[model samples]
Target: MNSRYLTPLTIMSLAWLSACTPTRVSNQVSIDSPAQWQHAANAQSAETADLKTWWQGFNDPLLNELIDKALAANHDLKIATARVREANAMVTGAEAALYPSLDFSLSGGREKRIDRIVGVPSGQGIKLITPTADAVSGGLAARWEIDLFGGRHLEAEAAAAQAEGSQEGLHAAQVGLLAQVATNYLELRGVQQRTGILQRNIELQRERLRTLQVFLKAGLANEADMVRQQTLLQSTEATLPVLTNAKQNLIHRLGVLLGEPPENLENRLAGVGPLPKATPTMPNLLPSDLLVQRPDLRLAQSEVSAAAASLGSARADLYPKLVVSASGGVGALAVGGFPSLAESVYALGSGLSAPIFNAGRIRAHIAAADARLDQVAANYELTFLLALEDVENAFVAHRSARDRFSQLTEAEGSAEKAYRLVDAMYQRGAGDYLVVLDAQRSKLAVSDERAKAETAVSVAMVSLYRAFGGGWTIHSGIDKASIR
Candidate 1:
């Protein structure tokens, strides 16, 4: 080969080799962390499985209907769906950079120039006539940045990761909505049950007050006892308003969750009964299951992946870039001419550019990306740990509440029997009025405690389902199906 050509080829080969050199490797770490309760043996064998629709187990038609409506019309859900669409569009935009960009342009204009002689007599100066000319031009231009160092590829990869992250975020939003709706519904039912209990106790107190008044009239009980009974009845009556207010508040919250006004739901739920019974005991999976089913965790993981890709893209900027450009056009300068006097012009060219200096901006970007990846990795780990904590805490709560409900039920029954026996004795003149009063109070206390215990059990089950990443029918809804 000639010396000059050989030198140029050697330099080109060196540049190619430099471009091939590895600049950075991804340091993304897995997000899965073992639960505190999970044993080593179980951890090793753990694997994520498909998520199930756990809420259907409740078998409440009203709850099912509300959840369906919320999924369709809730404002927050609409926002999340819109975010997913925006992310998908961003992915498309990033992928577009991998190909050539072609643009078309057209222009038409006329210009006239007047010429006058300088430093000449006004009369002697000849007036120069200039003709107006019209120019019309149209062209197609193309430019492509050759991905010589994987910059465009890295950018596309980062964008794809972000899109996936957004999808996971949407799922997380759905899960949160499911949990909120369940919590609000359970609270509403609990309040209703409490109100019913209060009403029944108030009626019993009123009856006791009447009985005391009759005894005082018949010289069987004193005025102090009658007054005490009257006070108790009034106190019990006072509780109803507070309970009613709480119940109404919960209904309003549910209305918002369902994307409707409270008045609209009042009629629909007028006959709705107490909260459903306990959720069935489903098989509990291992903690590692969060990696697949917990959308927030997956979103964090995707963020880490995106950060790693971004680092790669930033590092690619440290090296040289290659670009190819081309333009083709047909133009005419003649006015009122269609295809006549038209001329064609075309050109093709290539260029190479390297970042020589930019006040350390490129290095800072690469470092920022690296830091972001680290931050995402840490966040992922934290999310995994938090998920594990949630599952174990929910499990403990469910078990504790379940046992408490059983014990309270037994206690309430015993109290009811004792109260009945005491009441009969007092009615037969074998016991004092104080005994009847104490027994009745005991019965009311036991009943209230039992009702509260039942509510706790239901709420705990909801928490367990949420912590276990269950509930929410992912496939039945329109957004779930049309999102992709």
Candidate 2:
């Protein structure tokens, strides 16, 4: 406790104590976010979404099942999981470098020699020496570098941050995979519905063609009417193949998403199901909610932490390093039919390596690390801004799509009523055949638009969920050890 008794070694130890402790990495960063969404006009509910199973809100059991399957079997998710494991391994290895390492080694040698000088006995060597000998040795060695400047600690810190980033990456992948599966499934259903609508119209036209043919035979209608009806039927039939092809592609894509072969679902999904309905109200989230919810943003922030730790490590390189090493072993030399006493050997040493003149290599490394930190900082900010933009964009798209779907549905209903009235008038000879055909066309077009609009509404909802970084897998346990 006496100040006068402080030694140079004590002062150096104090310096090491201050310098070797790694600075902590912040797990969260601050970003400016809007309090409310840009397009909130048509939103039915202000409630926050249940992002973990947002697809279930559509009330489609099949959709929910598909999302579950994708989460379990998706190849991209598997890859992300593997990366997380790899990062975890790296973290452990980096940390291990901060502690002492022990190694084992063994060596043995045997040799025989005969004296060629003329003597009383040809096989005899020098009288005082052995003609053959064998020696053996083994030992445990240890080496430790004292982290006087926090170099090893910072390396471990950087690796730890990277591991956390990989965990976030895995979550990000889950979010993307679920959203993709849901969107593709919705589009497939939409296409199927459109195909059904076209088929119904084609059948109606075929029946009209038959009636027109009878009228021509009875000399009441011209052959031109039957030909026109036939042409309409053929054109409508032609569109069926396109829709079928699109459906097939979607099925194949979905199969791949679920980690199955493309043709694996050909027999199972033969029938079309109704397109998923959008939830009437979705929970709105705050801007700050995105920072915690969006895995990409979290991953980006982790990258910043890693880069900062790396800079710390690089700066530490400019300081001196202390290495402690020790080794000990026992060995015996054996002569022909005899043995020498075993000798014990041991060594312990401590050394310091200070960067004297390295042609600015260490400085360059420090500069590079600084640049990397700056890059990641910029990237983190970019990611935050992009996340906000994503939410706003998805909100606008979702609202607009809902609006469009509503308008299209109303238009389709009106067109269908008009078609029915025109058909009745035509049957009574009060309206021209042209009027009926025109009304039929209008109804078909409106119906097709309505189906597409429905698909858009659902897809936009998926986008909104994805933008919010809302994906919950059983693997996303709250335990930090689980993530590692």
Tens digits of per-residue lDDT for model 2, 221-308 = 8987778788878987898889999999999999999998977777766587888654634656776666667789778878888988
* Poorly placed runs, candidate 2 (over 4 Å): 1-19, 22-30, 41-49, 113-130, 215-231, 278-281, 335-339, 423-441, 473-484
Top candidate (lDDT):
2
Q: How accurate is candidate 1 locally (lDDT)?
A: 0.75
Cα lDDT tens digits, model 1, 348-442, are 77788999889999999999988888898899788878888887777778778879989999998898899899889988989876677678777
Listed in order, each prediction's TM-score against the native is 0.85, 0.85
Error of 1 at 6 (Å): 15
* lDDT values for all models: 0.75, 0.79
